[model samples]
Target: MARLQSSGFFDLGDGRLEYHFVGRQPAAAPTLVLLHEGLGSAMQWGALPETLARTTGCGVLAVSRQGYGASSPVSLPRPADYLEHEARAVLPRILDAAEVGSGVLIGHSDGASIAALALAEGEARLRGGVLIAPHFFVEEVTLSAIRRTRAAYERGLLRTRLGRWHADVEGAFRGWNDAWLDPGRRGWTIEAALTRLTVPVTLIQGTEDAYGTRAQIVAARRSCPPGLLTVRELPNVGHEPHREAFADTVAIIAAFVRRVLEDEGAGEPHRPDGAPMGE
Candidate 1:
């Protein structure tokens, strides 16, 4: 593994957000912003971020959301407005503090939703985005899986493994699980909001993902500005494609980022059929 670095925290008003920076900084390469899943923390990513950073030559910023990892505990139930806050409120501050003028965003699951919302306004600094196992709409299977996960946490060995990553595994689990299962959140769909994003986006989903279906990809393809979007479905993979097929995930992302940057330096910023960046 590339030499790993110590993790730290950034005060974001409500709490201090935990994060880790990997790869050589102040390098002649684009920055790569990484957002973890609902139950993820900086440590949970393990060696993936470091490996990707070393290969891509991009400085990696991997972060745990407010209520997860070594960050502050969630004081209350997750707000229905959490995703919105992540986009409009939280992310800008993070980018500003990091001094990330422009780069790519790699978001998984809940992180994908957050990235979609955050990139809607199209910061000029943004190069592109890669979303893995993103969740825009809920599936019956997903809720069922979450229920199963809760049971496993209670009766199975889920706690033993998760405890190593999260300072308070219960806080992380309840913050995501409870908010998602809340009946009021059932109708939450971002198809309309996502349609407004102009950034070049690549959505990756597993063919076997039980939490989402082809309908989710179809919605994203139809909603996003045409041609600027790409979708890749990996066969025989599940919800956590990055974990199940790590090399493939990294390869696709690396290629997409390099291509976007190359196109930006050319005349147009997208394929002929797709809309330009920030359209």
Candidate 2:
């Protein structure tokens, strides 16, 4: 039998956000919540969500955040702590509305950063996380790459390509592009919050990722420790490892989720707010 696919919008109080489920109806297992890159969306994930669900026996829920895809358009120029706010407040609301009580987060680029922040702040429903090319702190390479992206958007290719995935293409581009380029956002870093993360984390980065460096992997490893952290570096790949290395990425994600479920089943405690218990 063919699996089902469906899409919908959630009224997140602040605004509406678009989301889709590619595999099971109610989203299964500790649902694999997939978060998109800055300019990417649920559709932009291509077949990965469905593939992940099949590979891991979990439901894959992908959301288009605030200003991307079929979601509401932004007013331009998001705040520096935009990701933090989403992680701390908005994510829980979305999850509650969707009726997903627990999940394993798989985040890419900006979405990855949001995953890290959410975990760090002790989001209790999160069993673990798979962060791909996540940035804890601002880096020159990231800013530079984003600047180039803005130039490309201005030149047309970036926007035109983004249009296929986003309903408000300009809002998607400028919201992410403008925030990172803002000088005030340069001081942004979740390094301190990282130490508070108790659940396991898997960090996947490409050696050739222009937006970030191995420094992110190194830092996450240092803070999260050996048992709690897993690092995977794909050689000769760029920003989007999941898109660029689909087969390998799915394999890693499936294995990581299995490990997390095993560990949790053994009775690792969590707080009332859903954050993992202890550091």
Candidate 3:
């Protein structure tokens, strides 16, 4: 199994983001970079990082963006185009700071949307991506869920639960919730970005997700290049498939990572006897 190499703060000159690094990547192998959901942090990923490293035989790096976890805080009422800004600007810097030469982005929810944008806009050495519960456009179901979340936050239940992981729970909640629920941002959609992706992508969605619907997958299938995208729908699973269907999620991701590497002729890490390392 891959062991945890380090866990600490990563200084971005302007901010200090928390991060966890697992295992080690060889020169030819790709690193797995995990991006969390809107209200998630490096700690929120739980054991998925270590499991991915062990199953794929690749290094795993999970980082918390600014305004969440132990990272720096942001001003209130974020702009409607914040997600786009994150994709085109912040993500590239994170990759460069981590010194990731080649990578497969594994992102959940809001993170998934960011990954899609990065792939479309261009991130050198980005091999491919696995997007879980991504949102391409604003949906009424998403808004309804956010409203309920806001209610819970006002009652203090949600805040108490999220406070365990986030240093500034209010900032974490408002930064994501307020921006997404803005009426002026209702037309937000990344379909144009999806159309520009040149690398392979796997999109996973739960059938019972409260925040989105099958429309998301349909839009992705319609927009992405033919034969470049793969879709997986989990039966009876909720939004957090990584936690709800841990083994199945890991298996699917591991297979995709291996296939991408093989297609790129990057191959897999080998043992001393020349057999595949993760076999």
Using lDDT as the measure, the top candidate is 3
**Positional deviation of residue 36's Cα in model 3 after best superposition, in angstroms:** 0.5
Candidate 3 lDDT, tens digit per residue, 17-72? 88888766435357888999999998889899888877777888898989999999
lDDT of residue 17 for candidate 3: 83
Best by TM-score: 3
* Candidate 1 residue-wise lDDT, 1-279, digit = tens: 223245778777778888898754523346688888888987787677777765565668887888889988886599997877877788778776666766788898898888887777677777778989887877777788888888988884988878888898888888888998988887888888777887789999999987778888998987898777899999999988888888999888877876877787722333222444334
**Judged by lDDT relative to the true structure, which candidate is superior, 2 or 3?**
3
lDDT, each prediction: 0.79, 0.81, 0.87
TM-score of 3: 0.94
TM-score, every prediction: 0.90, 0.90, 0.94
Candidate 2 global CA lDDT score: 0.81
* lDDT score at residue 37, model 1, on the 0-100 scale: 88
Q: Which runs in model 2 stand beyond 4 Å of their true positions?
A: 1-5, 25-28, 266-279
* lDDT-best of 1 and 3: 3
Candidate order (lDDT): 3, 2, 1
